[model samples]
Target: MAGAALPTAELTTSGRPILLPNEIECSLLSNVELEPEGSPPLSSSIHLRSSFLILTTHRLIFVSDSSAAAANTASYVPLASVTHIFLLKKSIKSMFGSPRLKVQLSVGSDGRVGGMGTRSIVATLVMRGKDDVEAFVDKFRQNWGARVWEREKESESASSGSSLVVESSASSSGFDSRGMRVVGVAGILRREQEMWESTDKSLQDAFQDLNALMSKAKEMVMLAEKMRLKLLSGPSQAGSSNDEELGSKEEMQDWLLSVGIVSPVTKESAGALYHQQLSRQLADFVKIPLERSGGMINLIDMYCLFNRARGTELISPEDLLRACSLWEKFDVPVMLRKFDSGVMIIQNKSHSDEEVFARIKLLITRPDALQMGVSAGDAAMTLGIAPAMAKEHLLTAESRGLLCRDISPDGFRFYINLFPEIRTDDIYLVKDQGIYATWIKCASSPSRLQ
Candidate 1:
């Protein structure tokens, strides 16, 4: 079957194809089928059925659109392998059937299609959804003709040659052409120099007006990514670097990481699939931050971080909310949760309330906690989470009867619930072995009440 022959594409946890460097998705079409033509009555299993076809600058990716996620798979046909794109034929049979187009592919002697091959085969893309087939075909042809991947390779070769020249001469002179000391890797420094020299005129033009800046946004993002990578590798390359140099590199890394989204999925690019694509992208983006934040983060905080990374293609609150809400439909590792206090957060699916509650239980049982109830800020520090998030957890624990809240001039605080241990019939009665007895000893101490 063609399924065994085609190259498989790896998918993110959210079912989005893992994009290659410089690869950008240009269009999305759902309910499409890819069938290899000119076969000896090919079996049904050979065709990719009812899939979401994504057109990128480098490939045509087909991901199964089945309701059963475990049954889904993905594959791709690289544009480099495609030799010709056939236009739709004007025939009576075509007028009534699903709109389709054909692509000629180069197949190797090893019975697989690829860039350099000895044989040829035809693959038909059958459009079963209500998408503009003509428009998709036009985009397909444009991307194929552009050969962006090939051009990127050529640029890299040229940049590599320039990098070698700079490395040989950089030791002789510690400064760049503009008299700035070399900071990071010598290879990257040389590329930066060449890039700036080439774009100096464009940079001057871009700053004169808003329209110019808008036009040059892509270039600026590219430069930011280069700097970010340089900073990332700086610490590893720093053998005997001073603390000041290290500090500056760290500061720059943080700024660049927060400000650069090399390729953000935009409404202009994904069209009808904007929120779906955004949801997948966000699912992938939040994994690292979620890990650093102990498997959860405030929704508002996420909105800021996501927008900051997106740079010029900032999404609105409504857009972010819509994108997050779509996560329920997709099989993603992260989920959106709302507490009784109306605070929303994005948390990993594996995050457990019981684990958080256990930590809070341990924290509140201490002698100081027994003398004076713990505030949200105190819990925040102990739990290593945001104060607002800690408060939400505290309130949730309170509702569960794990703890009790007290409001006074001192502040709002939470103490371990002693109500369950207290004797209701007699105010003076206390269990000698329980938390109530412990609280009694602590509350009666001289320094605690004063």
Candidate 2:
């Protein structure tokens, strides 16, 4: 059945709304409704029923109940469209019934609540859930008064000009007294001197007190970001940058890029919702990091990286585990995986040992790998993953009949999956057309070039 016309709002794959950059979720309620009260006789004839209301810092989203035998749809009422919110009338009769808070919102002439510069329209909110009415009202007032959206706009504008402003000021300071000199030994010397001075000053300042270090953390993060941008733009500016300089610049950029998390979730910040919210945020945050780590990352390694990015708001290992366990409750794209060896990792849900096995199979089938078998470190480099993670992948593949383990004083290693190829009836037999024959041929060759 067709439902009432409702505005649509986008939701992330994890079911969270795609908030504007810098916008944060404040409060969430499961089930609520909206309806107009005390309208004209003709207008009052229209009835709106139970729905789920989500109160964000910027908008009120009403999602219609699915069982309404109508299209489950969402409508958004921007906070900017709200002019006044009437307090719930307190009385014995009101206290006995469900709490209903009325909100006065300005709607356009076309009878839609919006902020597209149209005339005002009045609307009311009827809360039918077991929630703190006063709390919701207070949040609404706080969000309206804070005007965070406006502040975000100002911040974006400031950041856009910050680089240009800094460059102009630095140019006026006459730091570059020498006219265009070929960037060679002299440039490297000057850069080394600047880095040493900066590092020395930072070390001295950091030792002053814990509080001083905490205070300087944000500036340190900004400095790192600035340095990363400089490295990224340096190659573009220097037409004759050497390969060695470019490689160093890339390394520096990577180090600096890992430096900060502007708004890390903390136990204090998320309160009772810490684990749940952290799980979702961590799931969102780890995608790129996991991809860079080659589809899997050790839980302990992730804990360190996460805590380092969080700076002072360090969470306990227990908290990290709890957050990881909560991934089952969410629809995030990543999962917390535990190997038989009791090692834990965060990996993409789609990441499979079969894929890693395919790569390992291809690697060890080569003449060199066939002869030596692949050590954990060798596999780590070949698979582009951590040595421990690669070992786990290799073990998993071994269990799945795609590889075999080799343990000796030389160290634990994995070889091509010869178990399936080797005839159990004739262990020494090498089929002319199979991987066994190819592997034997590669293994027997004195020089791989043969």
Candidate 3:
């Protein structure tokens, strides 16, 4: 049987290597390679051409651009497999030659490096670029020594234990405290007991001190997570939840879910490649939120979301703008788009105006919408997007002649583009079959026409 092919590493749409959870990029260098230099040649040829080497907390990613295509493929070497990293030797002969960094790794019996069952393999990285080899080596060593993967493993285990605790607690009695007698006045006694616990001298004093602030902060984060969980389960419970209660619950959940970013990439951590790293992290971070926002999110809203996620380490608007601007240089699924009106938004690169236009066309052709032009808010509800974003889409459709705008004291609204289809020469003329005719029939009804 043919040997198992290496597990193909996953990549982001923009060609950036997808990092493991808690994995942080330490350094990035262009024009680097990995090859077995002195090993006896095997039956199969191993090629190591020009590749981008990314050093991260968990692995070293080799991003190789395929000569046949515009896109690149990535391969990774786990840091755990590294037996020893060979320090670069400085010699007069090396002064005029390309710099090289070598690493000794354990390759398993199956020829894969790292993991419990793997043997060992020796690999060398040739730096062909004019970049500082010494700096790259320093970063590589730093990342290896950090042992971030181990820390992440520990954290995962700890969190799993905490989840189990939460599950058990949730299944048990309503309250954690257990010290009350059963009697006729037991219910009243329990209430008084709870009040007395609240009034405990130590507890009362704690609230008056700095500990209260700390406790509140922790409670706030937990509350947010709880609310998010409720929102996630809300639709399933909708049958039992009244509409008004559900609406309020949904609003509260949205607010809570928007409370934070558990972890965020920062300039201090990513260094010179901060923007590039931020761009990639932003791409990953926005997928869910963007989908919920109807594939387009205001730059201001994103800034707030991003900063909130970062928690105490908030980034300035300028930094956020710079990071967004860098998205063009990297292969990211989401891009920073500026409307003609100068309003900026972060939109999925795959998001098409044609799709929105098609939806809008369908919406306006509806009997109700035809009679009453769709306001920004009306479009917002129909499109499931923010009103501001919906207005932008409407304006964009109008610009493309897919729709027409009507400004009235009531508000700015859009109607189906009947301009081209309508016979301007004869105001009353209606084509037998067309959007205009359909719209006319709908509009002609007094009850339908507002």
Candidate 4:
């Protein structure tokens, strides 16, 4: 923890920072450190090492690059709180040492960073990499000058205040701004109709052209996220939802969740570190879908899901593959695996083949399974995975001597590998107690085979 001086940034399971509502990442630096300036260190002497600097439209975030506590080890300086940014000075000493950019931040007496404070502190961002530090500083200055967050705050404040003003005026004057009566059910109905008309007009205008849709994309993403959250809380908050309603809500939630990525890592934003940052973002994005697919998903399926979430900012297949390849260098929980058949998939490092094999063993050892064997489709249903993935597991189990493959006119099926338990010398000899014995008992029952 960096203590109370700097608020910690929230991160997803795969270590990507959670971007604010409309905050967009504008720049990224792979290597940087946050160091306090002056001798009598300003309240707690906050310091971060080997951190990746991410400059968004709203804040300057420093995220630790190391694997341990990567999720928790992040702090940000809101652009709103930054009083001044001093770019790296051109001097002979700068030639031999790392470039440093100084940022003056508003600090309160409580030793916390905020919008306005009685005192201020100067913090130095030590840029270790020689990779385009000038560009990042330029972007920092640009974002600060834009003051977009302030504009958003002003808009939100105005919108919220407008409704109260209307209600207050209507109550006092007994009429709305449009001269409609305020004391009856007809007034309420008229207001509701007006709201729906406005919404319909907005929707119609948004779909008028591609450029119109592009402009409204952010609003749509925000609306989707809001609806998804509402659906998520609906069941828990209401408690009266039936199974069908709950199931439908869950399905709708899944759809809305994939509607968009509010702040996607892009080549323009990440620059030289594009693929690396994209890899981290992709790793974080895949966690949910991977879990749903039983801890593994084909790379093709992942690409589709990822690009869908990214919306218009789609990546080329080559870029996606390159990003996935970089995962081995990072300490992410997920990894890309290529099976013997050359089928590539993304699976968790903690995913155990033995656990999957155990499930397969249980499925195949049943009396019905023992008599007729199990097909890839059968395993797919039992495992809740794709038939292709199920087949891979079945083949791996067969290779490990846990099961045996049986091909017949009906279809490809896997049966328990009882060769190890069988007596080769005696053709009819069966083990009194073992998998072979179980198979014999099941085979002897005509009804079971049928």
Residue 232, candidate 1: Cα error in Å is 6.8
Q: Indicate the worst ten consecutive residues by lDDT in candidate 3.
A: 1-10
Best by TM-score: 1
**Of the candidates numbered 1 and 3, which has the greater TM-score value?**
1
Which parts of model 2 are misplaced by more than 4 Å? 1-7, 38-56, 61-74, 116-133, 150-277, 304-331, 417-444, 447-450
lDDT of 2 by residue, 75-149 (tens): 666777777777777889788877767766665555554655354434456666666667767887888887777
TM-score of each: 0.85, 0.69, 0.65, 0.78
Model 2 sits at a Cα RMSD from the real structure of: 7.7
Count clashing residue pairs in model 4: 0
Residue pairs that clash (backbone atoms under 3 angstroms), model 1: none
What are the per-residue Cα lDDT tens digits for candidate 4 across 1-450?
443467778877656789997888888887898877764455344667788889998988888787543433778888888999986788999888989888888888766787558778888888997578888889899999999898998989997998898788667745654876666787677777886787788789889999999778776666677678878778778878789988898889878766567788988888887887899899888888998998999999999999998887999999999999998877789999998888889999999999999999999999999999999999999999999999999988988999998889989999999889877789788768788888888889979545
Residue 424 in model 3: lDDT: 68
**Candidate 2 local lDDT, residue 37:** 49
**Candidate 3 segments exceeding 4 Å error:** 1-8, 35-37, 42-47, 65-70, 93-96, 116-122, 130-136, 146-278, 310-337, 365-372, 416-450
* Distance from true location, Cα of 137 in model 3, Å: 3.3
| Candidate 3 clashes between residue pairs 3 or more apart in a chain or in different chains | 14-331, 106-119, 106-120, 107-119, 107-120, 107-121, 108-118, 108-119, 260-309, 261-309
Quick one: ranking by TM-score, best first?
1, 4, 2, 3
